[model samples]
Target: MGNSLSDGLTDAVRRFQWFYTCHVRVPHELVEHSALSLTEMRVLFAVMHGGACTAADISRTLGLDTGYLSRMLTQFERSGLIERRPCSGDARSTQVSLTAAGETGLSAASAHVRDDVSTTLDAMTPGERAQLIASMGYVQRLLSPPADAPQVRLRGPRPGDFGWIVEREAQLAPGGTHTQRERETRTAMVVADYLTAPDPLRNGCWIAEQDGVSVGASLLVDGSAGSARLAALFVEPGVRRSSIARRLIKACVAFATESGYGRVVCATDLNPVSVAPFLRPFGFEELSNQGEWEKHLKEPRAF
Candidate 1:
């Protein structure tokens, strides 16, 4: 049984490797036409994004041999694609940067690669695209070191995000008190209300993204005359306790304050214990034993 399971796992891994190499990698013909080999393009990308980069920096970032990378840099210089200068502080090292010509070349090459990739992605259904992105993120987290973890960013909702919000909220909803169907229905109502809101500037939704995949979400909409209701706040189980929830809440509250809301209130189905840690630090006071929490913001707290 052990051998059988091991063989199955190995086969799965092999299949994934084949699919990745065949389907995920940029086609060789495209790279050939871009005037930059794949490795050269990667080196250029490293230099483009790595401000004040040295030859050593590119080597370390791309895991290329120092001798090989130096040869590439020399070729790039000959082509007038990059400029290198001795570091002022450390004369032994050289600073590398893309010249205008280099930037133009790299941008053009990048555009071609992006267009090619986009064609493939455009063929996928919305759900398939989301799943593929989420799966890639999961694989990256499993394989990458902690220091290399992708930064979480907060952004306004995009197309198909509202549906995802409802689904995720329902899936992550605290169990035992409400059925999944009940939670889903409630979340759908909240999303619908936000969608039909009259004043777009007065209400907001923030989606927390890590590596371009949504992991958490929060909603702030009109409550009373001068209050905003914070609802549908949830984080993915895999990313909970990592300050994503806090960041989402901060964004919502900041938007609320900017929109001239006097206070922000949250009515959660979660018990107080589950919600307190996320709310109390933000000056939210429990308004009831049930899950009502509010924070009166006379001024925005420095986040």
Candidate 2:
């Protein structure tokens, strides 16, 4: 019986490994480019996304070894793909920005990768595609970066952001996830409403980044002079733990307080599985037990 149990456990481990390889890992071999290596592609992506960055910052963002990054930097510099300049505040530090050639190369490569992924995804049935995407989403949330991970941020929602926010809300609602067509049209209308709103605080949203990718979002919705509600707080699965949710929460609270709201409130449909722990540390109390949980933020707390 012991031998049989051991065999069963071993088989389970092997299957798990196989599943991880098949579903979770992107095959880097498929990303082959004649002009750029994989490391170069990653560096270029980081520089392009951040607008301006330094070698040290790039290493931190990608969690890459500095030695390896230096080599890549040298190659990119030689190719005239990036320019390095002295950091304004620090003479010893250098800042890197993309050259026009670098930008064009990165864009072309991005388009190629997207086309390849789309082609492959197109081969699946709609239901199969949905399941694959949902499963990946679940894994993404599970593997989200830790709270103290480096974050990149922008101040608030820009002109085309309402649509992005709507799409985010729909994606996060599980069963209520919207289709691409629904996302495009309905999100456009939602954006229009936000755009027309008189108050800046009423129609604003923030996206949190980890490893140079947008991982989660929070929104400040209409409220009276000194109060606002935190709405549509959602984080992508793989990057959930990295304190992005907390940062987003704090952003909403700060926005409320600065915009003349004395306090901010948040409501969560309590799921023992996913909702409670993140709130407890931020002065969130067990306001009710009827399957809904609420928290009010009156002051900032160190996260």
Candidate 3:
């Protein structure tokens, strides 16, 4: 399977290379072209849109070799294609911008690719465009893994995300030989049922994905007569301190409140980490019982 995946990816890249190269790599195709190499045009484009960009910014965003970009900038400056000035705060580096000539060049280069893409897209049917976008999006996510802070966003369930929610929570329940697999399995089933049920009280079922990968989930289900329940809040252990769980709970509670629930309830395990100290900030108060927590709200919050 691994070898097949590798082969498939290689073939896909090979197939995409010709189209990208013909449009981007060959600058001579444009009537009023910059006559720049592919990488140079990319650098120019970066500068054209880069209002306050440094050399390092261009290199990082474009994934260009440092030495190569420096040489290109020097050549562009000599040709009066771009204006470079030392940064005010950091004299060690320089900021870049496209001069009038550079803007004309960027316009030409952009037009060449833009028209080609428009024509190709216009020729394709809607279904074909969707498939192509999905495929290209897959490739884009694969190539550009998250580099900055891992952003965890809560979105309603897409296809197969419910399964991810189940799988991710199941893998985290085991500790040692005395693992409580049965309890975790039951919990997953209950959550899955709640996810698919068509009750209006079911406020929302949100899955949290970190950098395009599902890492956590939370469910807001019908709890009591006039309240909502926050259920199945979990984040992968490897990604714990990222505040994904907090965001998920917050989003779920907001939805419940906005959906006209007077109060929200949650059940936690008998541990400080689970219920006692963990949910203090979101205005949850521990009940007189063992592991039950509740919050009362006057106004519903918008998600």
* lDDT ranking, high to low: 1, 3, 2
Q: Name the candidate, 2 or 3, with the larger lDDT value.
A: 3
How does residue 138 of candidate 3 score in lDDT? 49
How far off is residue 190 in model 2, in Å? Answer: 6.7
Q: TM-scores for all candidates?
A: 0.59, 0.44, 0.57
The alpha-carbon deviation from the true structure for residue 238 of candidate 2, after best TM-score superposition, in angstroms, is 1.6
Clash totals, every prediction: 0, 16, 0
Taking all chains together, the TM-score of candidate 3 against the true structure is 0.57
lDDT of 3 by residue, 70-185 (tens): 98899999999988899998889998988888787677667766787788799999879866775665466556655457666778877766666665555665464234455367
What lDDT is obtained when candidate 2 is compared to the true structure? 0.65
Off by over 4 Å in 1: 1-17, 24-52, 64-84, 97-159, 172-182, 195-203, 208-215, 222-228, 235-244, 254-263, 268-275, 296-303
Tell me the TM-score of model 1: 0.59
Write down the RMSD of all candidates, one decimal each: 6.8, 11.4, 7.6
Top-down TM-score ranking: 1, 3, 2
lDDT of 2 by residue, 90-151 (tens): 99988999999988877765666577678889899987986676566555545555555455
Off by over 4 Å in 3: 1-34, 63-65, 125-142, 145-202, 205-218, 224-241, 255-303
